[model samples]
Target: MSYQALYRVWRPQRFMDLVGQEMVTKTLKNAIITHQTSHAYLFTGPRGTGKTSAAKIFAKAINCRFSKEGEPCNECETCKAITEGRLNDVIEIDAASNNGVEEIRDIRDKVKYAPTEADYKVYIIDEVHMLSTGAFNALLKTLEEPPANVVFILATTEPHKIPATIISRTQRFDFKRITAESILQRMIYILDQKNVDYDDKALKVIAKAAEGGMRDALSLLDQVISFGDNNVTLDNALLVTGSVTQESLFNYLKFVLSKDTTNALKEIQQIVEQGKDANRLIEDLINYCRDLLLYQQAPEMVSDGELGLLDDKFKELSQQINVTQLYQIIDELNKQQENMRFSSHQSIYLEVLTVKLTQLSTNSEADRVSNVDLSQIELLKQKIENLQRKVDNLSSNTVQTEKNNEPRKQVRKNTTKGQKNVKINLSQVYSVLNNATRQSLNELKQVWPDLMNMLSVTQRAIMHVSEPVAASENGVVVGFEYAFLCQKALEDQELIDTLENGLDRLIGKVPSLVLIPVENWPEIRSNYLKQRKNGAVVIADDTSEQSQDNDDQSASTQPTIIQKAEELFGTDIVEIKND
Candidate 1:
């Protein structure tokens, strides 16, 4: 007897025998039980998921000589013939080859006939989408209003090409991929029955590589297994498929997260040097990222299919890479995979993809800085605020003493014939100035050492006199220094009485009055008589004698205030009377 491959030997023989297609099987079973079977059916979905098998079972059940509860009794000759493809009443058509209008016309003529032996004549058209529009249209009329005791079952991997008219008249069943668990369970059953030695991990890898197709999984197992071999291992599975382990991809991701470009590149180099498929490597990476995303969202769970083989460590790593980064990495890997098709340097494309991934590792540096936990930022802000408070306390504790409230007197230099001299006590004047003006005055005083602590400094004023006036009859006029001009103007009303009294009390005479810029002093007075008229005691207009008289006045004024105040308060306070 010739050998039968695993997939053919394992083909589902009944509705219940089909794996992972319970919905279709159950519906078909109920339909058969109720005798509510449709004349035509369309089964569509991914390959290897049992659309054709379901169609066959439905045919067998409907045509069986003796049926029990809508299930075929294999004991019957009619059911056995249909199952073995010997019955003329049940016909399986490969629409791919018989897809022209002429071939369909032959089917159209056949639909007119009555079944010779079976209760119903069934036509199963596989890959019906391959039929041309003319062929589809030719068959649509008979399909919509088919003869009694006739059934049509259309199957296709791609159904979009089938016209809506044909699809609507037929009952449609969309078959889905048999899930990993379903496929793996089936694989285990087959291996056990075959007495093939295998590890669960190897089976899982094969199941995953099949990607939800039972046929693909079984076919893969056949390729990987040597029937006489002791057992299958993860390594043998990896080698047969040219696929990398999820662990390798996970380690590459760890290197990527840690920004270990060198190690990541070296790993890729190792695989590239071994001549492993670069595109498959990218595919493995993308799947790895997918699992990582699942890990983060769904807890530490993985597929019993392939993920069961990986240890808990890979699962933990899966949780570390979140969906966002995983998506980004997969996007990059996909782009690199696309680039590899066109580029001559396949290894370089993979390297570039890894390098781009590693660059994202540095963004974690910025993340480290910005990720300063809210508590840390708050702590630093609080520390700054505390230091500010400390500074405020120190400043508050430091002492500052207020000066005396005595009027700030402006000093006046005695005018000699050839010298220009003017004076006043600054301290007395500043005491009366407003706060803002006092600050300006202090700043101005910095340029003059004597003025810094002095009561005042007099500016010689401008005056015009048409006639000479008696000294005792006129009151003395005081002009403020330039820096205090605004202060002097603001307090001009305040100084009237003080000036008049001080003139009489200190000089013992009411000198004639004038106020002017200090620069205009010489022109206001010519000699002693002119000075008395102008409210200045200009003894002579001669420049030489002016210097001598001014020297005598300073010698007298400094001692009276500084010397006396020094003895009284232990602080220097100079007083200069402008009168």
Candidate 2:
């Protein structure tokens, strides 16, 4: 026979053999023992967490004639046939390739027949979420009312993509990621069984690199074993897994925490030049920092197998850095990590990250405060007192002037004189009011806050004092509490465009903006109402020839009839003339 991979050779053959999935295996074993197994089972979790393995084990245990306590005897003919994929009753389907309506219809047709040699027929579909909508519908009826002595097992990494109806009909078991400790122990067991001399540190690195997948751990271990000529060493494991050694990470962090930018950049350059992945390097740093934090909080909890990066040097470094500095470092690294995802130049980002980390201060604010000079504190106190005295003198002077000169009325007059009036387009305001409806006004009000949130801070501040008083399909008249804000809002073209786009997305169309002071709005409305009561047409008296010329200029700037016709058809067929 050809050389088989460790993952294939070490595939879990029984419920007890499927490591890191005790809950799923225990429930399945009990279900088989009690004869309470559901006709349909949905196994969902991350890849390599034993979803398919558990399904196969359950199939064998239930079908084995010489089973004991829900455990299959591999010696039995049925168990051996299922294990060797030669059993007619236990079928395994890769839904990724055969996910079609016709394929599922064939299964539906065959489900009625009894098993050929076994007590029950088991169908295991892997990556079941890859099934088409039509296939899902086709299999729905069979899953809903499966024939006697028939079982359907669906396995998927992403259960959310499966339709809710199919999920509801099956008993679900969610497998969790295997812990690092369990993976490390499993690797040790396998290595000892093979009589391979291995360093425990190498096994630790391989387990951490596996990131909770037994199959991945075994695969990595296989590579490391082959690379080391059957001896699993730390250097070989690190080389195979592309993982940074604990010492390298500790030295890099030491440079960073000591504010040694030169050494830190050199370390990063060396790591990158060694063909270490930028993402993996950053991830290792992040994990190293997390281990330092954990070690600081609970030293006993930090073991050699899990977070093995926390060595004695790491403990000493953890003491040098405080909790606050760790938080800032992690936050900065995380932000840079996100930026590195979309960027093609990762080495430049890594260099920039080195500079940022080195520039970060190790001293917390409390430490700085404690080291402050007493003389400087007294000097600051004197400056604050002097400012307070000046403010008090100005307040007294102002109060005296107000009492003597009746300054309130004078100040009001001066304020009114200094404030510039924003000229309201009364004609446009009247038109909007005439066509306005409660529904339009309510719609504007509903989306007002969301629109405000979308604007920049300065734009939002300008629009803060404004409210939509009347609205129509074509325009909205906004009443501002202050005249200055109204004036500022009218002048901001970017703000106007932003509001138009935002409102268009929310309420279906953009409307023209009309700005006026709140105090002026009531007076304008009252004047228009009085003119209507007196049987007079309400029109702006400022409709002079210059205004008409301005309107004509604006109209001419708009798309002309010929231009619009060209747009509707094509510019190739249209002609323009200056005359």
lDDT of 1 by residue, 321-380 (tens): 665577668777887888888878888888888889988743444456777786698886
Write down the worst ten-residue block by lDDT for model 1: 462-471
lDDT of 1: 0.67
List per-prediction Cα lDDT, in the order shown: 0.67, 0.83
RMSD of each: 20.8, 15.9
Runs in model 2 lying further than 4 Å from the true structure: 304-309, 361-579
Which prediction has the highest TM-score against the true structure? 2
